[model samples]
Every structure is written in structure tokens, then in C-alpha cells.
Target: MTDLDYFDQFDDEGTEDSASKRDSLPDWVSNSNSSLAAYQAIQSLYKEKMQYIRGHSKKSHYTKKGSYHISKSEVARAAGLAKPNAIFHSVDYASKLTKELNDKNALLVASKEKILLSRSSSIKDLSKKELQSELRGRDRYKEISELKADEIVDLTLKRLPLDVKRQLYLA
Candidate 1:
């Protein structure tokens, strides 16, 4: 066959596949003929990408990458749009999505900081005598159990508060 005919055959198959995909889309996406519909389509694709990145989805279409970040062009391409800007044509929708993503990242960072702070603060909050006893206890446990230094530290931290409470009750 001529090159033109060969390519035409693939094009016809692609059209049929795309037509089937279009039929499977949501009723609103298939029925509407507006820019809003395009935006909605891109939004849904974006959520799917996020879900895949977060390991919440097992869809083969979204390949896992080293970086979790998703871009505007990726969403646009997934929605079969020619231009990424077309997806973000609605300023309100674009800004709202951006704000939501930022807020989620901010909350994640805040919670991580809180956990680190609590861990360090627990060690620092102990009095000098308590701190000394904690270290001595860790060493004793290490020697007795032949455990690694890191494991001993973890064990001591887990037991510290309870030990303090017992000492308080005794005194």
C-alpha cells in the first residue's frame, strides 16, 4: 500500500477508538458543547493523575514517575486538547484548583513539622536527672539485649513517659 493509504487506515482506527472513548465519558461531558465542559474534562483528568501519583489508583494510563508533580500540559494532553491554555481558559476554575492544591501541600507540611517537633520536644522536655536516667536505661537495655543503638533509642523514647509517671507515683 502507498504511505498515504497506510496512514489513513491508522487514522480511521483512531477515530473509531476515540469515538468509543467519547461515548464512555460522563453525560455532562458528552452532552455539553461549551468551554466549561472542556475544563471539567481536564479537571477530572487532573484528579486521576493526582490519584495515581498518590498511589490511590492502579490505572495503567498513568505511569508512576520519580516526581509526583503534575503539570497543566499533562492534564490537557490527557483530555485530548490541542493547547494546555484551553483547559485553564476559565480563570476562576484554574485559580480554585491551584488554591486547593497549595492548601493541601501546606497542611501536609504543617503536620510533618508538628510530628518532628513533638519528637524532639519530648526529649528536651525531660529534666536533667530524667534525661540522665533515660540514657542510662537505654545503655542498660542495649547491653542486655545486644540491640543496636538506634533500636535502643527508640525503645527508650517509647518507655520514657511511662517510667516518669511510675517514678512520680512512687515518690
Candidate 2:
């Protein structure tokens, strides 16, 4: 038979067929989508653990030599699962779980960035004294809080480091 016929044999079997036969997005993309959905569900169910994972996962890049893809092992680690251990024996199941956990980590990072943005915006609404207090820590805020409003305004109006002034809402 021709080369085309030989390749078509696998296509008929529905095993490692070409992209034209299956159509739609790649398997990795579909898998990542399911993984992301599963991770969101888990995050809602296990908020505390997910938070811990998010905090600890900052250093883990999961990139390969030529690609930026995160590895399944790294994902599983972030999910608090041990490799070659319980709850992930089957290859297919392990892969699915890894994708879910990795996607969840991505979501965690995104949410953190969003929270920071919202917090900065909210800070702008604070009064000068309140902003100064926030920037200088609670102890400093307590001292400033006891001062008269005019005194606080004077302190805020004084020339200060740009960052401190910005934090105090004077900039």
C-alpha cells in the first residue's frame, strides 16, 4: 500500500491520528481547560489549603528548556500531592489531577494580582492621616490618630520622601 494508506490505518483506528482527523483545539488545551475548571472547584472547596499552595508556589516556574509549560509534577506538588504516592497511581488520573492543580495555581496568581490592584485603588480614598497611618504601620497610625486634624494635615503637608507621601495620599 501507499505511504498515505499506511498513515490512514492509524487514523481509522482512532489512536495517534493527525490533527485533521480529530479537529478542534489541541488535546493539551482541552486538558488545561478541564484542569482549570477542576482547580476552581477545588479552590472553592479548600480555600485555606489553596491559599497556602498559592503562597508557596511563587518560586516554582515549571518551565522547560524551550517551553514555558509547567510540569505535571510541579502542579501535583503545589496541590500538596506526593508523586509515586497515594491518590495518583493511574497515569491518566495523575495527568488530569496535575493539570487541575497547575491551573488552580495560575488562578491563584491572577487573583493575587487583582487583589493588589483593588487594594491600591481603595487606598487612594483614605484620608491623609489614615493614609499616613497605613503607610507607617499601626503603631505610627495610633500616634497620628491622636493628633488634631490640623496637626495631621501639617505633617502630611511637610516635604517627605515621594514614596511616603504617595502612601500618605498626599502625592
Writing each residue's lDDT as its tens digit, candidate 2 over 96-131 gives: 655555665576556555543454336655558778
> Model-by-model lDDT, in order?
0.54, 0.52
41-148: candidate 1 lDDT, tens digit per residue: 555654564454454222232244312344566556665777767646554355644554445445444443444345433675565877999999999867869977
Candidate 1 ranges beyond 4 A from true positions: 1-34, 53-67, 89-171
Poorest 10 consecutive residues by lDDT, candidate 1: 57-66
Clashing pairs in 2: none
Candidate 2 achieves a global lDDT of: 0.52
For residue 102, what is the lDDT in candidate 1? 47
**Every model: Cα RMSD to truth:** 14.5, 16.3
Task: Name the runs in model 2 displaced over 4 angstroms.
Answer: 1-84, 89-91, 120-171
